[model samples]
Target: MIVAEKKPIEEIIDQVKDFQKLLIAGCNECVTVCEAGGKKEVGILASALRMYFMNEGKKVEIDEVTLERQCDHEYLEEIRDRIDKYDAVLSLACGVGVQFMAEKYFSTPVFPGVNTCFMGAAEERGVWSERCQACGQCILGETAGICPISRCAKRLLNGPCGGSTKGKCEISKDLDCAWQLILDRLKELDRLDDYEKIMPIKDWSTERAGGPRKVVREDVRL
Candidate 1:
């Protein structure tokens, strides 16, 4: 899941202070899971903003709406008719969702209300750890399901590097050595021999190197 953190209220207030009519849009997907920009968060933010404006003796019209997702056209279309009513929109979705909203509603100014953190998994409630970098080519099969690209501080392909000691990364005592975890997993799977085979140099083009990417399924197209 993509994890995000809400921006400081001060920064958000500064961005929409000039707009008399404002919309606080939320997403019901990943942001909801991460507790950043969901329906509840939208309400919290709206209330805070309302209190701030009221105390300041300023009049600002702030409305709240939570969409199933802000990254899809169908979900975004739900607000098309009402979008023009607001001077600006504060999207509490991920960076992708904010950009999608901006692109779809080109007339309205779209501002991101959260900082897109990373593709990660929940370690515990309110805690998420990075797991994938979307490097185009996956090597998890060879590494026994642990991702070195995201976990390794150096992004080492064949590693533990000389910097790892006692299964801990030299960079930090709290950080586990990703390669060590791979080796242990490989041993447990009786696939330790696979470790000897050198991995080929990764072609980074499959990643963000080639600009915007598109995945097409011709079979699914109308």
Candidate 2:
């Protein structure tokens, strides 16, 4: 999942201060999972932005709404009519969501209210850890399903990058060396032989390539 953090209320207000009418938009997907851009968070931000402007003696009209997933065009269409009434949109979603909204509504200026973070998995209730770098190459088959692209500082394809000290990555001692974990898992499965295989050069063009990739199922296509 892609993680994100909400931008400061003050900054958001500044961005749309000149606009008397504003719409605070939220997403119910990854940003919601991270507790940054959910419906509730959107309301809070809307209220805060309103308060900030009001306190400055500036009259501002603000309304809030949440889309199930801003990345989808259908959900975005639901807000088309409502958005037309606003001067600008403050999307409390990830960068992708904001971009999609802008793409869908060319007349409206969609502003991002969150800083998009890395692709990661949730650790606990509020903590998320990076797992995949989306490097266009997957090496989980040989490394016991652990990704080194995001976890390892060197992104080594085979063995430790020889920079690990005391099982910690040299780039940052706080992080564990991804290769070390791979070795342990490989040993447990008696698949250490797979480690010797050389990883082929990754073709990034195939992953996110020429244009936006889409899935069209013959059974589901209209």
Candidate 3:
């Protein structure tokens, strides 16, 4: 899932301080699980903003709403009738959702409420770890399910670079060497032979380096 962290209240206040009316929008998906932007978080933010305005001797109208997903057009359209009622919208969705809302509305000012981190998984409650970089070219098949691209400090295709020591990355003893993990995984799977095969230079054009990407599915299109 896409991981994100909430912005500081002071930073958020600075962004929407001039607006008399504001809408705090949250998502029910990834941000919800991560405890950053969700129905509960929206209410909390709304309360904080309300208190801030009240203490500043200013009157502000703050509304809170959580969409099933802010990225989807269908969910976004739900606010169309009342979107103009607010001076600005603080979106608690991922960067994608914030951009989508900005594009869809065009005229209304949209602000991000959270910092989009990366595509990752929760290692445990309150702890999320990076898992994939979405490099477009997947090489997990030969690496025994360990992703060297995202896990490696240098994104090395084939390595346990000389920098690794005691199964840890050179960058940090706390960090495990991605290649070491892969080697161990392969050995357990009895596929250590696959590790000997070197990977060709990756075609990065398939990634974001090529620019914004899109997929077209003729079968699913109208």
Q: Write the per-residue lDDT of candidate 1 for residues 64-135, one digit (tens) a residue.
A: 999999999999999999999999999999999999999999999999999999999999987898999998
TM-score of each: 0.96, 0.91, 0.98
lDDT of 3 by residue, 1-222 (tens): 999999999999999999988999999999999999999999999999998899999999999999999989999999999999999999999999999999999999999999999999999999998999998888889888999989999999976789999999999998999999999989999998998898888899978989988989999999
lDDT values, one for every candidate: 0.94, 0.86, 0.93
What C-alpha lDDT, on a 0 to 100 scale, does residue 204 get in candidate 2? 66
- Best of the candidates, TM-score: 3
TM-score winner between 2 and 3, please give it. 3
Q: Is candidate 1 or candidate 3 better by TM-score?
A: 3
Candidate 3 stretches greater than 4 Å from native: none
Query: 1 or 2, which is superior by TM-score?
Result: 1
State the lDDT at 157 in candidate 3.
91
Candidate 1, pairs of clashing residues: none
Candidate 3 residue pairs in backbone clash: none
Q: Which scores greater on lDDT, model 1 or model 3?
A: 1
Q: Indicate the residue-level lDDT of 210 in model 2.
A: 43
Superposed by TM-score, candidate 1 places the C-alpha of residue 182 at a distance from the truth, in angstroms, of 0.8
Cα-based lDDT at residue 5, candidate 2 = 89
Q: Can you give the lDDT of residue 41 in candidate 3? A: 95
